[model samples]
Target: MLLQKFKIKSMSLLTFNLLLAIWLAAVLNVPFYERMQSLTPHTGIKSSLFIAASVGVLVAAYTFLFQILNWKWTAKPIAIALVFIGGFASYAVSSLGVLITPDQIQNLMQTDISEAKDTWSWHLVVWTLGMTVLPIIAILMVKFKPEPILRQIVKKGIASVVSIAIVCSLLFVFYVDFAAIFRGNRDLKGMISPQNMIASFISYYKKKAPKENLPLVTYGTDAHRVINTSKPTQPKLMVLVVGETARAESFSLNGYTKNTNPELSKQNVISFAQVSSCGTATAVSVPCMFSGMPRKDYDERLASHREGLLDIAQRAGYKVTWIDNNSGCKGTCDRVHKFEIPAPLKQKWCDAEGECKDEVLVDSLKSYLASIPAEDKTPQLIVLHQMGSHGPAYYKRSTEQFQPFKPMCSTNAIQGCSRDELLNSYDNSIVYTDHVLNQVIQTIKDVPNYQTGFWYLSDHGESTGESGMYLHGAPYAIAPIQQTHVPMIMWFSPAWQQHNATEVSCLQQQKQALRSQDNLFPTLLSMLEIKTQVIDDKNDMLKQCATNPDGKA
Candidate 1:
């Protein structure tokens, strides 16, 4: 009976589309309007005119899209899908300040189930139902008048043409205002609700979805280990610790105010002061860093089918193993040995959600090394991927003992908390990460006769309420420095450093030089002493520091 009162008995399909467009322009675009208002200060008459023009353009744009797709069977389905997407997009923008770009969509698609659960909250549930469900109900209740197919087609075509003309005319008249808003702020396009989400989703799938079968292209086929006879006779073992969401600005080792590196400071490690990430998200940065492809030329599709550092290292006779505590290896460990936290290890370190603190990585690595046969000591390259400072659940990342900073934010709705609370929680996670890295260094030190070295590099950085942004995965070109500048640290056992003739003093001297994840691929190959045509000497940061004993290198 309630539904019957609101039902439309006779409405043309074009009229239905117009009403939908008005709802989308007026209701679903609150975030867009707020953003524009913030950008353009109130200048009385001019400000009012700009706001009016912007709404007109937005309504016309949506009207054009709806009119073109005005089939009897398809129009409602498309409208319903867009309404739901718009609602979620608005919430994400207003609450978290995340833009819906292709990279962000890719990150969402690749996120694991446990990680996805961390983003859930009661606020989100209420907001989603209120924004999307009510509108969907209203859409379903509408009843369009029956029309002949030929007449429907002609009428819809005319409506679309009229919408296009209106949109073009409004945009032309407000050229100066539109240009000022969009020219400097390219990411503003992502602020528009359903349009941005729709375009980004389609763009991501078109680029990333699999095509016809293609053979994998392997690199460094002629790769072979060049053993440093001067080194220990046992074997060479290097541990690469891939950190998650750690920004250089937050690390004391990189001049941060907090003492986030208490344990690391005691050790003799060189912290690279100026290091940039390949991308603002792990899905792109992790694969790109390993692919030996520089950031500028990296194509995720191509990187997936090509050999990476691990593949080439294994080919060169090193026992390459990837131990993960965050998401899966993102296909970086497909050709090499991979390890996950066993049930026993999880019992000791993991939470109810199966999200483990990074200490599990250290514990798991220790157990794995212990199980290896005493005599079978082929050189080892083990990667420890840490779940460090992954937000908006930063408080969950560190254990009670590791959280030094007080009055921390404990909920998933990080934006709702005070800024100090958020920073404190995030900093405590870094402190815990410090402990994990120290443990890794200690574990490698205890290994008997093997020549061991350690390298720590964060996949990317995070944004902490900067410029109305939270989290990471902003498009690389427009990404803030917080999301691109990452922390990197390197350490080596005394025996290993002496054996490889690596000058620690030289490395420390060059710590402030500009470097990036691109240096990782070739530098790692150089550290493993693998001989391959693929290793570029210019990209290796260690190349300048090597003493080149016996003039072999």
Candidate 2:
């Protein structure tokens, strides 16, 4: 009887392993596999294999623990829970194409999960079915066997913990070496164990410094200052509109079918048709665009070392202001004047059933802009960061009035949404954005005495159901055009033209120049006429024009 029981347990273990192998194979079908291959080619094959093996081992260990503890009836439920957890975790990691940092993961869970509560009911249903109902059915089939004694279970639990630790150690080692190979960094010599190697790899990243650290030039400096020594001038006002989740592919300015940018198209706006983004996500792009570092070298360690464009504008004697509608992450605009919409007031914007709209943030913006102190300005730089077209809940992005297309709202979740539906909802958001942008441009146009120029660029673009992908955050190397091909437009008022002819001509030249966010730092300094000793002549767009004389082809 003992021999027969041992054979039964062995067969059960084999079945568990087989099921886990099938699940592991299916996990690779998630859309991010191709992107992962492109981003870290050196570790791509090994990492994929490691991930598969880890999942298999984790499932097997869970099965073994349940059996060894004689908690056979409970095994099915625990196994089901593990499956859902593993699948969701894999999906999230695959979508990002990298292992998410602890802070980022925490922030994402807090904000995105809360925001997605209403629309993600289907996900909850799936979890319930897998974790509860399926397990009960499996338990009934096994005749609901009684659990083993607590002492025996404790012994099995300790063994399972040890096994998990070993598996995790192996995974950590592989991941660290993979990252080192992908980044082309030399491997550590002294690190013998996986845990130590991971520690060393993290230390290396934390200690890495920015490739360049050029100081900013402001308006009062002697080398390149723009302050009027000859005569007094009126306080200038410039509004830099930092758009959100806006893709260039959908904008009319970038040859899209829809007239999404009708107002800006009608104005004297210069749209750079081929503008690319530094990163696909706001966390990286927002800081990178503002900082001096190019996307290739952008790292969190350099965030504090470098001053942003806002800092440059502020040092140039401009009052910097930031009005934000997005979730406050990393406090990117801490030094600037910040006005966040009240949470209680925002709650009212939700429907009787509790659904909210993006326009609610816009409504708050209108009131906030009107309340700004009219008197104070030594030339003010107001940054309006819109909640724009942030999604998954694309249907809630805008109202029906803005919806030009029918059957627009995404019927499925972001992952399953049809391309046509995604575009329709996305375009509607752009339409609403255009209206808000028009209001901002008109307000800037009406501002007296100040030479106003409005520049608009999205943090990054979005994937609207492209190649079975529905959102942004693809790895940089293989990030689709939808994520990087972003819309950029500059509108210069007649007053700006009258006061700064040299700057206007420089901007016009830059319009044709092969520009990136790297040029943004020096370009803003040149436009504002801020002089500083720290500006690199080689990187400065204006200096490039001065040297080339012939424009960039």
Off by over 4 Å in 2: 1-82, 90-114, 118-124, 131-225, 304-306, 340-375, 410-412, 415-417, 537-539, 549-553
lDDT of 2 by residue, 10-95 (tens): 22432453353344334423333343344454565676775555444444454444445334545555555545445544444443
TM-score of structure candidate 1: 0.93
Instruction: Provide the clash count, candidate 1.
Output: 0
- RMSD per model, one decimal: 3.2, 8.7
Error of 1 at 475 (Å): 0.5
Best by the TM-score measure: 1
Question: Scored by Cα lDDT, where does model 2 land?
Answer: 0.60
Q: Could you tell me the lDDT of residue 79 within candidate 2?
A: 52
**Model 1 lDDT tens row, 1-553:** 8777888576889888998898888677777777887778557897887788888888988888887776668878988998999999888887888888988898898899999998998878888889899888888878888999899889878988888998899889878778888897888888788888988999988997545566798888989988656744567899999999999999999999989989999998989989999999999999989998899888888888888899999999999999999887777888898876689999988878788889999999999899778888788999999899999999998999988898999998888899999999999999999999999999999898688999999999999899889999998888999999999999989777776554455566668888899999998987788889988876776675554322222
In candidate 1, which residue pairs get closer than 3 Å at backbone N, Cα or C atoms, i.e. clash?
Answer: none
Off by over 4 Å in 1: 1-12, 38-42, 145-162, 228-234, 545-553
For model 1, state the Cα shift of residue 375 in Å. Answer: 2.0
